[model samples]
Target: MTTAPLVRRAHDRGIAVLTLDSPHNRNALSAALIADLTDALDAAERDEAVRAVLLTHTGSTFCAGADLKADGIGKGPGLLVGLIRRIATLAKPVVAKADGHARAGGLGLLAACDIAVASDAATFAFTESRLGLAPSVISLPVLDRVDPRAAGRYFLTGERFDTAEAVRIGLVTAWDEALDGILAGLRAASPQGLAESKAVATRSLREALDSGAEELVRQSARLFTSAEAAEGMRAFVERRDPSWAL
Candidate 1:
């Protein structure tokens, strides 16, 4: 099989590993990376040989959100949203083996997964507000994983948080001493049983979101017009630190 921008391998135990391969850019979600990731996930979903999918990266930083320099803007065709949706609906369970910094969009990817095991060194941030952009697409997974009050603080402040906070807020399922061991244990489970359980859980979660999504959007829209957001973006462009320091 051809190696994609994101590499994929099926282990003997029917566990498929999808490794984000762009280390130089901190595995930022470039257009090519997003396209390759979507394709790779789709292939894993279709392959009968695969049971569970493990998402990981091969660098010190798991992902640094979207590649803002690549396209002059961080937005990249909304591919991340589509990829997250695919993972959410996949029959098999998807686990994120996050060992490094998973900021902004990267946190969204982790949130979308059925289970997430983060290393103690893992760090997360929602820096979109600092850059004058909204974490609009990522808000879905963020809301799913984090409490609304916690989300408001991080979303508005764009502050960085540690792995323990991630676990406390439900973004990470657990913190593992060794990611390999956790992954091994997850891979040992019955794929069929895991798939059914994940499907039911995801369905319930989606229903809850569907019921209140409109109100969420309305509130976010109002925030877009706030003076703080405008000042934050201006400070970002001027190469000065934002005044809204936590």
Candidate 2:
């Protein structure tokens, strides 16, 4: 039997809810999923009825970061960067309903959203440093959203943090038990007003990401193909510590 699609989208009460449905890989940033998400966002942008968007996921893990085991990692930086930038600059207001953990590049997705409502139980981390790589492309959005000192600490240490810390560091807008109120508030906005307001609010971020994306993508590609990152990926598959950890 054929597998289900990686992302599922539904529309209700002027809100377009796009869910990451690939629990098998914990919603990893595989090429297929990125493409599907882009399509969903594009459709939502074109739909006049979709005044807002809620970005959520199905599994306990919101996203486990890049699917390094998959063949797409070599070319994933561009796709992932594009998707994140799309979310950041999308005309409609996008809210992340983060009910689970987000790590590494996954944190970039959360940061890209205009508003993020995470559950108290949810967690976050920037785990790229642990893998002998840097969060280069993701830094565009992450840095814009997070506190500079906090970003530096987490980026360098690859430390895991809880929802409270995530909120404190500006990784999420707020922590809510349920997303109903947030969605309701967003859905109540006038479509044109919301769109124009969002455009104004995100101007600086959009310009920064657009100008820096090419360089960040090149850096990501270089690191992903580096000898240290290769060893890190190999060790991850072998269930052993990377050489740098020794």
CA-lDDT, candidates in order: 0.77, 0.87
Cα deviation of 196, candidate 1, in Å: 1.6
Cα-based lDDT at residue 236, candidate 2: 79
Judging by lDDT against the true structure, name the best candidate: 2
TM-score of each: 0.81, 0.95
Q: Which ten residues in a row have the lowest lDDT in candidate 1?
A: 71-80
Pairs of colliding residues, candidate 1: none
Give the C-alpha lDDT of model 2: 0.87
Off by over 4 Å in 1: 1-4, 8-12, 72-77, 178-185, 204-239, 242-246
RMSD of each: 3.9, 1.5
Q: How far is candidate 2 from the true structure (C-alpha RMSD, Å)?
A: 1.5
